[model samples]
Target: MKIPFLGGRQALLDPTLVAPMSTAARPELTGGRRIGVLVQHGFTGNPASMRPWAQDLAERGYAVEMPLLPGHGTRWQDLNKVTWDDWVATVEGALDKLVAENDAVVAVGLSMGGALCLRLAADHGDDLAGIVVVNAAVDTLRKDVKLLPVLKHAVPAMPGIANDIKKPGADEHGYPMTPLRAAASMFAGYAELRRDLPRITIPVLFFRSAEDHVVDISSSRAINAGLSSKDFEERVLEDSYHVATLDHDAPRIFAESAEFIERVTREQQG
Candidate 1:
């Protein structure tokens, strides 16, 4: 699908274009066996939400790459035209690039971004050094989600769960509306990820908010139960919502993840 932009130029299904209020982080040049971290934002969201975490890692001498998912960070209406495949392909391509240049690569994501990171862990297994997620969802408690198949056809869109941050003035730069078709595809991706959870055995770190309006805590429980990672840890975000990466607990998430990355990569290097 072609999205017309300024100057009458069209966006060519490119997930790399830095959207307004969103920026794609480039890996920093660090010496030695460099580490690469692929950070992804949640569905209906852009790299803006994940940028802070990516920048944190970059400052610590780790190479970071954040890709804008297809149909995201653009007009919400365009989301109806894309599917889960488009989102997966974008991150997969980003992962390929990072793996090639870095000694060890870590995947970090939030919400649906977390689901995608889990997908990478499952697909790459031992190839990945570790995985980190904030308020990731593999399953949810929203009853309406079960009717997505029927609702997606009748209801074109619904109220979005963007900017679910408790902080007074923080915005995730997410779309204002949630296109049903895109949401259905996202749920479908979650189902597939759940089924393959056991395939992910790498070191995994999860940050869950104590009060998340968008994704219920049940999703975290399900993920913890399903994952086969022998080295797994869960951190509680006491003062945040679903968008914890942009909320009050964001610093803790960043600091803990940086420390986690160091420990995991050191083990791998040894």
Candidate 2:
């Protein structure tokens, strides 16, 4: 089932063909120390999935930066050329810059973006004020996922996993295909983050969809089981799917995240 907007036309394959919603930056409010919020999108997805959430933060006077991950927001074939390290480096650099500019920084992410946020929290625990993750994917139960190492070489692409929202007419503007080699690299990153979850001591607000088709609830269970964060909180999204940020509960996620950022910033900076 191909959507009309994302037709399988050749024009959809070029990274430079159109401007991506990622890499957006909002200036800090005047005369006040603003909290910085860095929002990230999921694997095979672009900043389109994260824009509304980031925009809400910007409107609330927080400095916002949403970066397009390396090889993402482009053709799926492009993802084959990059490794997971490249993705992590892009996000890490953004987080570092946000930390340098603001009094506090909160990391917000969805799906694999959540995994990257966990990685940031683990490595840069002292620098982060808090974290918000929606439908974070830490592990997978697919039996075929085990064949990725070999399948990556054999299969270049697979069906896409974009627009997993319950809302109608919502588009995430993601790649139409899924790159196999890049997925293998993502899994490697997930495994490493799972091992380092104990290092993430910052406050976390985790959201999981009750009926997600892309990532299972077990992924959230694994993250909660491994996290050492004393301030960890989990909420089940009853009205959404994998892309809760763009679904029926988007407003709830945005409003709650803003509140979480405010509460954590006050507690930490006061």
Q: What would the per-residue lDDT of candidate 2 be over residues 105-207, giving only the tens digit for each residue?
A: 8999999999899989999988898999999998998889889999998899898898888999887777778899999999988988889999889999999
RMSD of each: 4.9, 2.8
lDDT of 1 by residue, 66-130 (tens): 88888877677788999988988988988888878878888899999999999999998666889
Model 2 residue pairs with clashes: none
Give me the runs in candidate 2 sitting further than 4 Å from their true place: 1-10, 13-31
Candidate 1 residue runs with Cα over 4 Å from true position: 1-31
Can you give the TM-score per candidate against the true fold?
0.89, 0.92
Q: Against the correct fold, how does model 2 do in TM-score? A: 0.92
Query: lDDT of each model, Cα atoms only?
Result: 0.83, 0.84
lDDT of 2 at 109: 96
lDDT value, residue 18 of candidate 1: 41
